[model samples]
Target: MMAVALVLSAVPLGAETLILGTTQVPRHFNGAIQSGIATMMPTAQIFASPLRYEDDWTPRPYLAQSWEVAEDQLSVTLHLTPDATFHDGMPITSADVAFSIRTIRDNHPFASMLAPVTSVSTPDPLTAIIHLAHPHPALLLAMSPALMPILPEHIYGGPDLADNPANLKPVGSGPFRFVEYRQGDHYRLERNPDFFLPDAPRLDGLIVKIFSDPMTMLLSLESGEIDMILLVSGVHDIQRLQAIPGMQVSDAGHEAIGPLNWIAFNMGKPPFDDVRVRQAIGFGIDKRYILDQMMAGLARDALGPIAPGSPFADAGIEPYTYDPVRAADLLDAAGYPVGADGLRFTARMDFIPGVPEQGRNVAEYMKSQLAPLGIALELRSAPDFPTWAQRIATHDFDITQDNVFNWGDPVIGVHRTYLSSNIREGVIWSNTQRYSDAEVDDLLARAATEPDPEERAALYARFQHIVVEEAPILFINELPLYTAARAEVTGLPQSIWGAISPYLTLDREP
Candidate 1:
């Protein structure tokens, strides 16, 4: 195993192919506008970002060779790799960088992510200067692989931004090139010979093998048919898989990709528009039960919107304790008395599609939990991710089970959920709750540009207190899993992006 230049060895191209098992089926290859692991897993390999975030939240160069922030902190200058080119062999320039930023500003679901950016100016072929209206502390972070993937202006600079045919056949300037996606079976990506980095992306190819069932996917890993499986959704099977020999199971490198499983409400509606009703329902769910019984010792209680271990998570917020009597009393106070048949009301519940791990199981558990307490729920299942996303985007459903990420910074991930300005129609993962408060709005706006860490944290602390009390979304236990990989796999991505990153150094030994 003689290394040539750190990431590269003299192994033959076909010697090392990484087969990844997943239950996730990606809707598209473009991650510029799309969020989450489904699209992100492929996008990070096919397309490269200006920078990638290390596990410690530090920024390192990816496509951009170097970057510098101005003294006033209102702008960032990116010096891209001179020889970087898309899969089609077109040189990557500042124009592409500029276009990508503009596209992201207008179309990205996190509408508030680039709210401070006024314009991007390209002075030279390799230099891009991003000018901000305010001091954006998360500018570099917003350019991370999952957050932003620099799209080639030549290929995608056409009529429709989000609805182009080129989306399916992506041409990117990363370490890998898109080969083919055979709908139900698998999506494959081959190594890019013309990659910017010298002797990088040690793998010959990467294949995402899709499974209709979690059991089948796990079986592939057990039989050595697949090299690894990520986002292992079946919580009950984690312990069983961890005991298998030649397999490594752990939840490391996911610190910044904070996923919280919880109930989100449609505040645009009647009973849910009432805060008392919302709080009553929040008081009904037992976060402890979800962790102890459901999560298989894989999760912690995510009491607030912010994930635990984050520097900004407030430990002092008064938790909504489990009190069915109080819930009943609150329902009575809110003018919804239990009927003669002992049912207060029923609302439709939808869960994100993929598998039962996300919202389906949680919705079923909540239905049982809330039924005895006089509230009835109608569980609605989305056949796929797109359908589930569409329902949330269109503001349909009384409440839904969802898994959302806090991608590194409060400005990048947390702001869009609470900011009133981000309540855009037909945008999944935006302010879909339809909640708006002038004070919460003010705090988020200030925190977005506030450079001082203590000041931004204080602002977020207040934001958490207000949202938790109002109960637009009830915090539940974190979505937990043990991603299993073969012991032969080395250089697995240790960044915050984890399994979804480019995995440039990933290699398998014979």
Candidate 2:
């Protein structure tokens, strides 16, 4: 295997370093356990997947040189690039690929993402064949960098995988190598000279600094202490940040299907179990007002769980309009008549962390709107993400507000939010709503294995129709994703997967 040599300018006294800021610090570097963008941003640099998504959202080769699907649509064969090597200078082979697939299938939180995959076999050092229980049309798309990162078998193949100490210092065959991680401070990575890609990563090193607040992080950008913010900044701060000289704000570098923030009811609990009560709550809150006031009119009102832009979205279904009078009638019909206390019932809403201010504002707005209908809505906020995740997963909350990303495709994105099999206890963000329907399950299953793209889309459309009619979760609006950076920074590629790739592609000139 040929190795690429580090090409540093001899005239430069030191290597060029790029520093970025983020509000959330990664709990660990392992992608199989964590799904947050905070974890993906840093881990993207340290690990390489067999396949990657292009700017246009098409699957392309990375570690794997090429792939072919069988005519029966039940298996796929992958050919590895001969030049790929791990950070430790070991050749990356088909065995490592097989190990990573089995590990992710057995241990990953969203293992259902690979539910169709049955087994992996390697006939030689450069080839990997994957067998599937059924035809999965979206298998290639599901193998994007974030979902299927290739791990060094020597380090992660032992027992107690999650508890392994090497998780904090991951070793992979990506363009960059992990250096050190200072908790709550920053994480660092250096360029990999042995990377298969020839002279590709342009930057010498990368540093991601952690900030607790958005304002301080924006200030760091202005003072040149940081080059960019990995995650999108709030819309309220975008204008102010743009007004600063030499700064640019863009909403372009995000995944194709953005996240949808909505109100979810625990169907396993009371009051919410009634369809009329769920519909009453949906009509009580004004989605238009929330989109205008809370979201700064930067988002479009969601018609359903799927984004309107996606082919699978059911455009014929209309969204529930703001109607308190109708909401009150529905509540009364559901047998919760307004009592002498001027209230039908009381409930609390737990706010997820990512958008605290917007969440609280929307909660207060809903409280005021629901008051006229004789429904008391209380607002509750968790101290951190873990607390909030635990509450929602275990069905501990009455009603809650959270966001779900469709991750480019509904098969890989919105399926977990509604699939009954995904309702695992204590598992964060997997069908926490506890919704189950025989018809809906049938449609989802058919869509997963349908080889024809048009037929698959039709099946998803039917699924959306049922979900919207059932009203298990109230669809609010599509959240806009963005990334802010200084003008001097160049060569940053636009991404539909939430993070820029080819870490070496970025450069900041003083």
Which candidate tops TM-score? 2
Candidate 1 positional error at 200, Å? 2.4
Per-candidate TM vs. native? 0.88, 0.91
Which whole-number lDDT from 0 to 100 does residue 27 have in model 2? Answer: 86
lDDT of 2 by residue, 1-510 (tens): 000011122212125777778877788888766676777776678888888775666678898889999999999999999968899888899999889888887876665667778899999999999999999887887677777788889988888788888789889877888888879877778888888888767788877778877888888787777788765647677767768887877766555446787889999888989999999988888888888877877767788878755656777887788898989899999999999999899999888876754566667788898988998988888888799989998989988888887866777788888888888798767888899988888888888899898899888888888898789999887876666788988766566665635464677676
For candidate 1, the lDDT comes to 0.83
lDDT for each residue of candidate 1 in 1-510, tens digit (9 for 90 to 100): 112112222222366888788877888888887876888889889999999866666788888989998989889999998988899999999999999999889887776678789999999999999999989987887888777889999889977868887688898888989988877677888899998888889998987778877887777788777788886646767887888987888777776677778889999998999999999998897766777777766887786878875778899988888899999889999999989999999899998876575567788888999998888899988788898899999998789988888877878778778888889799888889999999999998888888888999999899999999999999887777456888999877766768777778888877
Candidate 2 stretches greater than 4 Å from native: 1-15, 308-311, 500-504
Q: Candidate 1, which segments miss by more than 4 Å at Cα?
A: 1-13, 88-90, 160-166, 336-348, 378-396, 424-427
Judge candidate 1 at residue 163 and give its lDDT: 88
| Model 1 CA lDDT for position 134 | 85
